[model samples]
Target: MLYAIAAVILSYLLGSVSFSIMAAKLVKGIDIRQHGSGNAGATNTLRVLGKGPGIIVFLLDIGKGIAAVLLGAALSGQSDWVPVLCGLAAIVGHNWPIWYRFKGGKGVATTVGVMATLAFIPALIAGIITILVIAITRYVSLGSLVFAVLTPIILVIMEASLPILLVSLILGIFSFIRHRTNIVKLWQGQENKLGAKKGQ
Candidate 1:
């Protein structure tokens, strides 16, 4: 129990390290959350800082999620549920990073990392579908939503562990909640595309 608690706390802290915000400050002398779409995420990073910095932030955020799950597994002696819980904790922290005054990204990239680690085949399939959606529609938010909504169904079909399935469900709900504004904009045909200029 003590180990699990420590793992959760450590994972949260790891996720709280927003690479987008740090990269923006370092490269552009500005807060990423105040620019582009005012979102501390890869899409906004791409808009505000260009491809290099955006990709860096995306990879770093994914690394945070992967690290959290691995760390939880290690600290919890490879317990079945601890890693899943820690992964969820990391996603939550990504969405509301403590270091960033509880303001942070949408957790799509982090969710990708967590789900990939938890269930590789299902995640890979879902990811392929998501990329296809983005390629066809150029709507990153829609791709993200599709990934979030489909991952759990894939997991259930693959007969994943209860804890993992539950975490995926919660993560899906969190994704939808975080993307509420994007959903509205998409419905109104006002959402930005993948390569649109900043402040679009």
Candidate 2:
């Protein structure tokens, strides 16, 4: 139990290292959260810093999620739920990072890593749907919301463990809550689409 607790805390700390913020500072000497959508995320990275840095930040953020899960698995011993909980902790940390003054990115990229690691097939299916939505509508936030909302349903259909399903549900709720502003903009047709300019 002590090991599990330590792993969870470690995972949160890992997630708190915002790659977007680091990348922005390294590449442009700017705080990413002060530009674009004022979001410390890959989408804003893409908008502010362009493709290469954005992709790098995305991959790094995903890697953090993967590392957290692996850390949990290594320390969990017989508790299968520890890894899932650790993944959730990582997402929570990404959303409200201690290192970044509680200002952090939405957890979509980290969610991708966590869900894909925990339940591959279901996550893949939901990922495909999300990509399709993004490709068709160009709304990254919408795609993210779809991915969050659909993964748990897919997990339930696949007969995943209750703990995993519950975690996914919580993640979905967190995604929606974090994206509340985007949801409003989407309804008002004022949300930014992929490839749109920073202020467009």
Candidate 3:
């Protein structure tokens, strides 16, 4: 019981360290949450702060997820459910960070890191496919949607434990929810592309 509680709280804090918000504030003294689509994630970072900052935020966010999972596993050992629990903890943290008023990024990158650690091969393949699609379509939301939707399915196919699969599905659903605004913009043909705007 103590271990579980500690893991959960630790994971959430890890996730809540919104690197995008921090990067924006540090690099330009602006709140990432106050601009672009008002999202504290990579896409919005790209939209409001340009590519360099966006890339940095993306990597850092992914790093947080990876760090949390690695830490949980390292501390808890290769116990059956600790990895899954820690992964969930990281996702929850990113979605509702304590450090940032409980508002955080959409959890796509972090989720990727989570699965990649637990299910390395499948996550790698999914990540490759996702990146290809994003590169071709210039739609981060679509790529993320692909990542989210495919992750649990892949986990299931890989024969991960039912518990892991269940948690992964929940994480995927959360990713979709976070990307809701992006979905709207995608349909309306108003979503931002993955490059510098003209004259910028």
Candidate 4:
């Protein structure tokens, strides 16, 4: 129990490290949340910074999620829920990082990391489709939403364990909630696309 609690706390701390902000500041000396779509995630990073910094931040964010889950697994010792809980803790930290005044990016990248660790097959399927969607539409938010909605369905179809399904569902809801503004923009055909100019 003590180890599980420590893992969760450590995971949250890990997730709280906003790589996008770090990348922006390191690469261009600007706060990421003040530019582009005013979002501190990979898509906005790519828009505000460049491909190199954006990709690095994205990968690092995913890595933190994976690391968090692994930490839970190593500390909790065969406990089924601890890892998933740690994953959730990471997502929550990413979404509302204490280090960043509780203002953080949407948890899409971290969710990818967490869900992939928990249920690889379902996450892979959803991720592939997500990539295709982003490729075709150039709308990262749309692709993220699709992944969030599809992963739980795939998990259900595959008869995954309850905790995995539950976490996926919660993450799905979080995605929709976080992207509500983007959803409206998408409906209005005003959402920014990849490769577009900032504030376009």
Candidate 5:
């Protein structure tokens, strides 16, 4: 019980780091959430800062997810469900941070991170598909949405554990829910493209 609680806390804190926010502050002394698209993720970073900073933030955000899940796995060495809960907590933290006034990114990068850690093959497959979708469509939100919705499907196809599959399904649904605004923008054809150059 103690291990589970500790793992959840640790994972949440790890996810709450918010690399985009920190990177924006470090690179420009600004809050990324105040900029283009009003989002604090790689796509917005690319729009406001440039490709370099955006890529850095993306990698770092993904790293947070991976680190949180791995930490959970390490802490819950004896139990599988504990790590699943820990990984889910990390995703929750990324989406609704306790330290960021409950506002944070869409959690796509972090979700990719957690999924990758929990089920490497399925995650990698899903990531490849996501990249392809983004590259072909030029819509980051679309790619992320599809990826989020497909994670649990990939898990089932790959024959992952039932608990992991169930939690991943919940995570996927939540990720899509958080993208509700983007979904509307997408339907209205007002959604931003993946690449629009460094700045306006």
Candidate 6:
């Protein structure tokens, strides 16, 4: 029990490290949240900065998710729930990071990491379809929400463990909550496409 608790706390701390913010400040000496969509995530980084820094931050953020799950696996021994809970903690940290004044990104990239680690096959299937959605629609937020919704369905079809399914469902709820504004913009036909510049 103690190990599980420690893993979660450590995972949250790990997730709280915002690579996007670090990259922006290191490269351009700016607060990432003050620019573009005011999101401290990779997509916003790509928009406010460029492909170079954005891709790096994206990969690093994914790494953070992966690392947190592995840390849970290592610390919690044979417990299944520990890794799942740890993954959720990481996403929460990314969304409301303690280190960043509780203001952070939407946690999509982190979710990708956590899901991929917990259920690789389901995550892969949903991810492929999600990529297609983004490519065809040029709507990253829509694709993100799609991935969140599809993951648990795929898990149910595959007969995934209860903890995994529960985590996926919770992740989906978080995605919707985080993307509420984007959903509204999408409905109003005012959401920005993937490559759109600011105010476009």
Count of backbone clashes for each model? 0, 0, 0, 0, 0, 0
lDDT of 5 by residue, 1-200 (tens): 78778988988988877787888898999998887776767678878888898888888888888888787778887888887887788888887888888788888888888888888888888889999998998988898888887888988878899878988888878877888887888899877776664211
Q: Compared to the true structure, candidate 2 yields what TM-score?
A: 0.98
- Location of the lowest summed lDDT over 10 successive residues in candidate 3: 191-200
Write down the TM-score for model 5.
0.94
Give one digit per residue, the lDDT tens place, for model 1 in 1-200. 89999999999988888998999999999998888888898889988999999899889889888999998899888588999989998998999999989999999899999999989999999999999999999999999999998999999899999989999999999999999999999999998898987532
User: lDDT values of the candidates?
Assistant: 0.91, 0.91, 0.80, 0.91, 0.82, 0.93
Alpha-carbon deviation at 27 in model 3, angstroms: 1.0
Give per-residue CA lDDT, model 2, range 100-199, as digits (tens).
9999999889989988888889999999999999999999999999999899999988999988899899999999998999999999999999998762
Instruction: Write candidate 4's Cα lDDT for 1-200 as tens digits.
Output: 99999999999989999999888888889988999988888878888888888898889889888999999999989899999999999999998999999888998899999999999999999999999999999999899999999999999999999999999999999999999999999999988888997732
Clashes of 6: 0
RMSD of each: 1.1, 1.1, 2.6, 1.1, 2.0, 1.2
For model 4 the local lDDT of residue 44 reads 86
TM-scores of the candidates are 0.97, 0.98, 0.90, 0.97, 0.94, 0.98
Model 4 / residue 84 / CA error / Å: 0.1
In candidate 4, which residue pairs clash?
A: none
Model 5: clashing residue pairs?
Answer: none
Model 6 ranges off by over 4 Å: none
The candidate with the higher lDDT, 4 or 6, is 6
Query: Which pairs in model 3 have colliding backbones?
Result: none
